[model samples]
Target: MVELRRDPVVERWITIPRERAASIEGLFPGKQEVSRGACPFCPTAMHEREIYSIKDDQGRWSVLVVPDLRPILEMEGTLERRAKGIYDGMSGVGAHEIVIETREHNQSWATMAADQLGLVLRAYRDRSSQLRGDKRFRAIFMAKNYGGMASRFSHPHSHVLALPIVPRTLVEEVQGSEDYFQYKERCVWCDVKEQELAKSERTVALTDRFLVHTPYASRYPFELNVMPFRHVADFASSTDEEIADLGGCLRTTFEIVKNRLHDPSYSMIIHSVPLRNASEHSYHWHIEIRPQLTSLAGFEWGTGFFTNPIPPEVAAQHLRG
Candidate 1:
């Protein structure tokens, strides 16, 4: 069983899953394990269940989507929103799925072919679209925790979390974008993309349809945002051609980061409009990649402001080289 609890002061929802602690303990068995023979993501190993899959020309599954063995949120329960005193809570009723990127244990997104990466992106779009029909879910968050201290599993994979409520960070972003639109009558991300393209110092990689650049005020050293050149609010609405183009740009950017940073640990988050508010013109969809090179300290935790040691310009230069 799981529940969504609200923070009284901040009004943020926190997922309180009963089995999370035990699940996390089971994720990492021991620190000394280095062999890939015991990996569960391998093609030979057993999986819980396949929710979605994509096969290659030879009829072998190249990409697979499976339900998490120890999912934080269960899909079988009702929300059952209730209040206790001043606090509000609800059942953690959502979907948690994993996208197994490859059948081979050694392959990674950075090194994978563009076509294969495109198939993975297609899986994400299909899964999100399918989950959007459920009115209970407010948002679907797709994220990848790769390498370094950020990743618990060594296998290359990503997670899709269909959340009952929009996350605090996403709420803040939508609010900020809406405010900017009301003031300027334009999308904030479009303006940012335009400015970054005009000033190519922060631009790391670009394709005909997409642009990959370090944001003007990046929160981390090598933080990169991948956005379509055209103004688009929903990632699931992307065309097949657009998805392939995006795959190329994303793969190129990842290759650059890996080559420059010696394959650092990083997290990639897909930011998009909520399911209910699908027609939001003020907001634009993008992927934020944050390299786990820096750690948060007291000042960062106390204050919401992040201190980045490497400037965006320097980081962009390193990637461009």
Candidate 2:
């Protein structure tokens, strides 16, 4: 049976249609293609002309930074601003770098050791801190698109972009979170976590410091977000201990996804306060992990809405098992 939903953000009524799931009893259970032929991300292949790689004291290829061959915004372009009638355009000025996690072709986050993931997380923190020093960089965001939908490469890596303007999604979240905080005199997200935990519904996996859950009204099947348990405003300011705890959470999240979801393609992002707007009280740092289980149809973009077939309550139950 179809169900009606009330969205807090859109402040409107929505419908969730019912559908049957495909049976995967003997589906394509393929293993990860690790250490295959011609993996440039391998440590031995770091000498590629375009790669910026560094070695650790122990002599491992610990870090890598590369220019995206096809970047959304170009770095060498002039900042020419123009307007055509009601439309406006500006110079495409931004920096996009690919941070390769490891030299091993197959060592993804879930398969990596806790210490290794911690190092990758630290590298992200360090890179973000370094980019914030430049005044030209107004906003910085990092994203990992798994597989083709999430990325164009099979290597385990993420993209970091320093943009001239805040992203549209981030802008909406900042405004919404801030306004809700002011009116409620508390963080609405924090309130949400407390209620979710108390009710114990729509929660898939959890740790001492972080949790993974399907929101009350999900737009996609098996879509989830993993957020910190404590309150923090900036990702760069996280304590060393907090980073370790977060490493554990990251490991578990990927493990559960890989084992249960059958290695589905997903995109993960670390959302934090923008550099110029660092001290905003309304914004709280969080990480969102969304799996690409379904394609977006015309109805979604045209109406700016979606109808998730699997309810959050059911999705959580599936993941928990």
Candidate 3:
């Protein structure tokens, strides 16, 4: 077996090419939105603020949760449907909550300690359970968009979306995972872990409880998968210990990357079981982290194939070193 640091097959592989990167427009130039970003998410003094906040014993605010100012899916109060020329679209009716992870404007996930990240993860699970029970809600997804282009706000935060429809990505994952589960009579993600380990080509980082690898066919560049080696299926179902450990893994990975690579911006999203009719063992929970260093253009969107510049193995070696 090749050493963990320098696996030949893994190195010099195409992670996403330069032209491919250039192909994705509006990817670079780094999110020209929200000039001079400030602390607009701070807790207010009115019930009309529609924001909830947690504070430390010193009365200093720790975290803030508020409805998104520019909501993609704000509550319409009721669902009324109409049609356009040849397409059908509903009113943007969903909950978009901005989770202000910390008060520090400059600090981000990479700089956050494991304990701090754990608290944020707990907030996600807590909100997921609360939102999933809503009759109008169908799914709750936790996502973070870093850098200027990815989000309007620059602080370390994530969004908990309570969507009425199961997202297309969730639908696809269900179909793909379920098919593999039935055929192999085992969790496909578990099998994936084994395969990635055996291949050892994309492994980024491993800890006592977690393993981070680049997907064999990564949809995006610098895509890192953080999975619980024990095959936990739901992010909401994780224990406190697991959350803490996962947070540790997150912190370590980000710290290493920040130290090794100059890249500071990225996006992270969790792939967990759906809110309704979920087969616990049929799926596995994981997080995908992709740095905001590439763009997606027509060829990628048209052809449905993403080109990454830096190979996973090389990225991993650099990260591990």
Best by TM-score: 1
Query: lDDT by residue for model 3 over 1-321, one digit each (tens)?
Result: 000011233221111221223335445565334545345753433324535666788987687677876555665565444355543444445677878887676777778878888888888878777777777766678899887647776667788887766666777787788888889899998998989888877888787778898777777666789999887667888888888888888888888767776755777888888777566778888888887777788889888777777777777777778
User: Candidate 2: lDDT over CA atoms?
Assistant: 0.73
TM-score-sorted candidate list, best first: 1, 3, 2
Off by over 4 Å in 1: 19-37
- What TM-score fits each model? 0.94, 0.82, 0.82
Q: Which of 2 and 3 is ahead in lDDT?
A: 2
Error of 3 at 127 (Å): 0.8
lDDT string for model 1 (52-152, tens) is 99998898788999998768788897778979999999999999999999887787778999988999999999999999999899999899998847766
Candidate 2 per-residue lDDT, tens place, 1-321, comes to 222233444434333333433345634545332334676666666445444555688876776777775566556655554455644445556677788887777777778887767777777777778788876666777788886556546878888877766666777788788889879878767888899899878988788877789888778898887777777766777777878888888888788888888888898888887777844676778878888888898999798799999998988898888
Better model by lDDT: candidate 1 vs candidate 3: 1
Model 3 residue 12 lDDT score: 18
- Rank candidates, lDDT, best first: 1, 2, 3
Off by over 4 Å in 3: 1-32, 42-51, 80-87
In angstroms, how far off is 185's CA in candidate 3? 0.6
